[model samples]
Target: MPLDAESEAIGTLLLDRGILSPDQLLTAEDHARDWGVSLVKVLLSRRWITSDQLYEQLSYHYDLPLVDLMEHRPDDTLIRKYDPRMMNDRMTVPIKESDGVLTVATARPGPETLLYVRKTYGPRVHMVIASHFDLSWSLQRAFREQHSHEAVFALAEIDPEMSAQQVITPPQILVLYLLLSIFLLGIAFAPVPTLIVLNVLLTVFYTGNFLFKAVLVWVGGAAQESSSRAIAAEAGLLRDEDLPTYTVLVPMFREPEVLPILTQALRNLDYPLAKLDIKIVLEEGDHETIEAARSLNLEGVFEIIRVPASHPQTKPKACNFALRYSQGDFLVIFDAEDKPEPDQLKKVVAAFNQSPDNTACIQCRLNYYNARENWLTRMFTLDYSLWFDLMLPGLERLKVPIPLGGTSNHFRMDVLRELNAWDPFNVTEDADLGIRLTQKGYRVGVIDSTTFEEANVSIPNWIRQRSRWIKGYMQTFLVHSRRPIHLWRSIGPAGVFGFVFFIGGTFLSGLLNPVFWAVFAIWMIFGEDIISPYFPLPVLYLSMLNLLAGNALLIYLTMVAPFRRRWTYLAPWGVTVIGYWVLMTIASYKALSQLVFNPFYWEKTQHGLSKHTANEVAEASADVEEAKG
Candidate 1:
C-alpha cells in the first residue's frame, strides 16, 4: 500500500489507456520533474484532466470501481466503525456499509488505513478510487466545522461595543473623560501648577519615546553585522519526496487588476504545485476579481475561496474562512500584489528546520517592487527598508514580540490552529497574532527572504492606507493594555517594556509629532524667547535632545537602511523620511478621527496602481534564471 512512483493507478496507466495524449503526458512529466509534483497533480493543475477523469483512469488501471463521493454521503454508524483519523490523514473516507461489506473511497490507500479497515470491518472491505479533492471535501463534511460561522467569529460577538467604540474601551473612555475633566478643573483652579505638571509629563514622555526608538535604531544597526540570513535549501539535500505540504492564503478584495499578476507570480514559484494549497480568498461580492481570476484559466490548484459576507468584513476573516480548507503542514500569507522570490518557500522550510521547537512563525523582509516609481514611493521604500530589513531582525534578537507584517508570515499549521488562527476582530490581525504567539510561549523568527510589493505613490492613497495601519496599531495597543498586569506576567517585564516602547511609542510619536513640529517651527521663526517663559532649563534641554538627537538617529537609521539592499540611490531619499513621517503624522490624526467614527472600517489599499506590470516581474524572474543559467 506504499506510494509507488510507477503505480498502476497513475501516470503510465493513463497513457496506456489513451486517457491522456503522449504530448500531454510529456508536458505534465516535465512540469512534475521541474516542480517536484506528481504527474497527476501537474495534469490536474494544468486542467489537462479533471479529477473525475483521473479517477476513472485510476479505476480502469486498478480494476476497481470508481465512486463519486459527492453522490454518496457516509453515515455516522459506518463512519464510527473506523476512525476518522484514517480518513483525515490517509485521504480515504468511508462511504457506505452493505451486507457484511464496507465500501470506502480512497485517494491513497495507505497501509495503516487499509489495516485499520480490514481489522475493524473484516476481510470483505471494498476499496474504490476517488479524487483527492472529493475525498477531502467529504472528510470535512463528515467531521469538520459544518458552517463558516463556527470558524470565523466576528468582532461584535467578542465585544458588543468594540466595533462601535473602536479600540477605546468604556473604562478607558471613562478614565480619559475623568482625566480631561480633572485637567480642565486644574487649568481653571491653578493654571501655573497645571501648566508646569503638563509640561513636565510631556517632556518625560517625549524624551522616553525618543530614547527608546534611538536605542532600537542603534540595536538594529548593530544587529546588521550578525545576520540571520538563511542559506537556501540545497536542492538534493531535501528531496521533493521529503517536502511537506504548504498552504498559501492570498486574500483579495476588488483586486481584479492584480489577478493575472498574482496567478503568474504564484505559478512561477519553485515549490511543488501538488503540495501547495493556494487559496485565493475573495469576498463574495468581489465579482470583478472572481471573474478576472476565472479569465486567467488558472490551474485547479489555485482555488477560489469565496468568503461569506459577514459583519466586520476583514482580511483575517477571509483567511480564517480559507484556513479551514487548507491541507498544508505549514501555512503562509501573500498579499494580492506581492511577488515573493521563487525560492522563498524553500528558504522558509530551511529556516523552520534550523529553528528551535518553540518557533511558531518566521517573517520575511518586505520591500517595494516599484520603489523608484515616485518620490513618495522612494521614501516609502526607505521607510520599509528601515523597518523590515533592520528593525525587525533587531527586535527578534532582543526576544521582543515582533509585530508581523501583513504578508509572507509562514506558520506551523498546528500552532496556528491552537491559537484559533487569527483574531477576526483585530484589524491588524497579523501584528496582534505575533504578540499572541509570543505570549503563548512561542517565538517568531526572521528569515532572509523578501516579498516585493507595490508602494503607494499617491498622497491620498498613502494617507488612507497609513491611517488604517495606524488605527490598527492603536487597536492592538488598547486591546493589550486592557489586562496590563496579565500581559506583563505573560510576556515578562522586558517584554512589557518592549511592547510599550514599540507599539505605544510608534503610535504616540505619530500623534505627538505634529504638535512638536509646530512648536519647533514657531521657535525657529520667532526665536525661543516666546516659549522660553514657560520652559525650565532642564525641560528645554530634554526638548532639544528629543527634537535634534532623536530625529537625527531616525534619519541616520533611514539613511543606512537602503545600504542593506545595496540601494545606494535610494539612500538619499532617507532624508525625505521626515517628510514621510509628517505624512504619517497627518495619517495618524486621520486614524484617530476614524477610530472615533469608523472603527471597524478597513481603508483598503488599492493594488495594481504601480506602473510596473506582471511582465516586469516575469522578466525580472527570467533574468534571475538567466543569471543562474
Candidate 2:
C-alpha cells in the first residue's frame, strides 16, 4: 500500500530543492514501493542527500519548528517518567513543559506521532522536528545511568546462576579445597603410587582430548557441504522485502584507523541498505573513533552509539547498551578489522529460515585475510579454521553446544533480549552465551559464510588475545559446572562431555602441557630411570603413546584445517603449531593468574597493527574517493 499523502511529498520536496536528482528520486521511489518502506527512508538509505538537508525540508513541509535536541536539551525529569524504550520506539520524547502545555520533540513529525503526543501528553501539546540521530542521542544521554546499570547488572540480578559476577561459588571453592587436600594427602603418604595414578589420569585425559578433537574435525568437515549449497540457493531466491531488518554492531575501542575497512565491508553486503540498521558502538570516552565515524559522514542507516563508561568495559556490555536503540529484528556483531563475505547476512537469513523454530543463533566460519602475514598469523588462521570451520560444525552435528566465534554470530533479537543479552562479567561472553543458549533449550546452527579478519601478527599481541579467551573459558566452565546436574539435565549426556572436552579441555591442556613436556624431557635425558618408579611398565608405555600419538593427531588435524578454504599453503605451517602450543601454555598461565586476580578485566586486542590492515586502509580511501567521483 502507498504511504499516506504527506509521506509522498517528502520525495517531491527533495526533488524541488535539487537535493535529489530526477533519476535518483525515481530510483528511490521504486525502492520505496518494492521494499515497503517510506520514500524518506529510501532517500536516506541511498545517501543522495544529507540527513540535515532532508530534515530541514521536512521541517518546512510540516510547518513545525526545527529544534536541535543537542543544543536545547530535553527535560531529563520528564524523560525519566516515561519509558525510554517506548520513546525510542515512537521516535518522540517530551522535551519540556510550559505552563500546562507540554513541548515534544519527534523525529517522525507525522499524524501518528501527533496522535501519540495528544494521547500520551494530553491535548495541549506542541511538536517540533528533530533528526533521528538527535532523538536517539538524547534518549541515550537521559538514560545513561539506567542503561549502564542494566548492562552491568541485568543478568546478575535476574539470573545469578548464569551470571559470572560471582566468579566462583562457595560450593565450587569447597570442591577445589577437597580436591587439593586429597592430592596433598596422597602425595605425602604414597608418593610413588600417587604419581603413577596422576600419570595415568593425565595420559587418559590427553588421549580423550585429542581423540575428541579428531572426531569433531571428521564430523564437522562432512556435515556442512550439501546444506551450505542449499542455503546459498535459497539465499539467492529470497526477495528483498522478505528479509528482516538486520542490525550490525561494530563495537570498537581506540581503533579509529581501521574504521573505514569495516564500514566499507558493511556497505558491500548484498542486503538492501534500507533494511540494515548498523551501529558503531563506542565508549563515550573514545573521542578519537567517535570523531572518525562522524567525519566519515556515514549514511542514515549507520548510527553512532556512544556507550557510557561502566564497570566491566567489555564488548557485550557495549552491545547491550546499544541494543536498546536497535530497531532490527536480528543482530550480528563485527569487529573493526573484519571483512565479511558480501552475502554473509543473506546466507544467515536463509539458514535461519531453513532451521528449526528453536534455533536462536547461526555461527559463520571465521578465517584470516592475512593468513600468511607471519608465522603467528598463519598459526592463528589455522587455529580458527579448525575451530570455526570444523569443530563448530561437529558440535552442531553431534547435538553439542557450540561455542560461538567472536564475530559473525547472528542472533534472534527476541532470544537475545530474553536472556538479558550478554554477561558483562564474562570476558569471553560469546562462548559463554553459546553454552547458555543451549542450556536454555535453544539451538545454535552453523552456516558456510565466512568473515575474514586480520590475524594477530605479533606474538605478544597474540598472547594477550589468547589469554583473555582462555580466561573466559575458565569462567564459563566454572559457571556452568557449578550446577553439574542441571547442566547434565539441560544439555543431556552428550552435551556434558562436549562441555568437558571442549571448554574444560581447552584450558586444562594448556595448563598440563608443560608438566608432561618436562617429564618427557627428563625421561629422554636420564634414560627413563629417573621417573621409572612413578611409571610402571604399562603406565610408561601408555604415557609415551599418549604423548606421541596425541601430538601427531593434533598436528594432522591442524594441517588439514585450511583445506576447506583451499588455503593449502598454510597446511605446511601446521607442523610449527607446537610452538603455538607453547605460546598457549604461557597464555594459559597468564589467564589463570587473571582469573584469580581480575576475572572481568578485558585485555583489549590492539587492531590495525598488521601491514595488511595498512593496505586495507589505503584501499578503503581509494574506494571512498572513487565513490565521491
The most accurate candidate by lDDT is: 2
Q: Which 10-residue span in candidate 1 carries the lowest summed lDDT?
A: 156-165
For model 2 the local lDDT of residue 7 reads 58
Residue 410 Cα positional deviation in candidate 2, in Å, after optimal superposition: 0.7
The alpha-carbon lDDT assigned to residue 419 of candidate 1 equals: 74
For the record, the alpha-carbon RMSD of candidate 1 to the native fold, in angstroms, is 4.6
Q: Best-fitting candidate, measured by TM-score? A: 2
Model 2 Cα shift for residue 553 (angstroms): 0.9
- Candidate 2, 154-226: lDDT as tens digits: 9999999999999999999999999989889999998888888888898888888998999999999999989
Clashing pairs in 2: none
Off by over 4 Å in 1: 1-9, 19-39, 45-52, 63-130, 133-146, 154-166, 222-230, 233-236, 524-527, 614-629
lDDT of each: 0.77, 0.91
Cand. 1 TM to true fold: 0.86
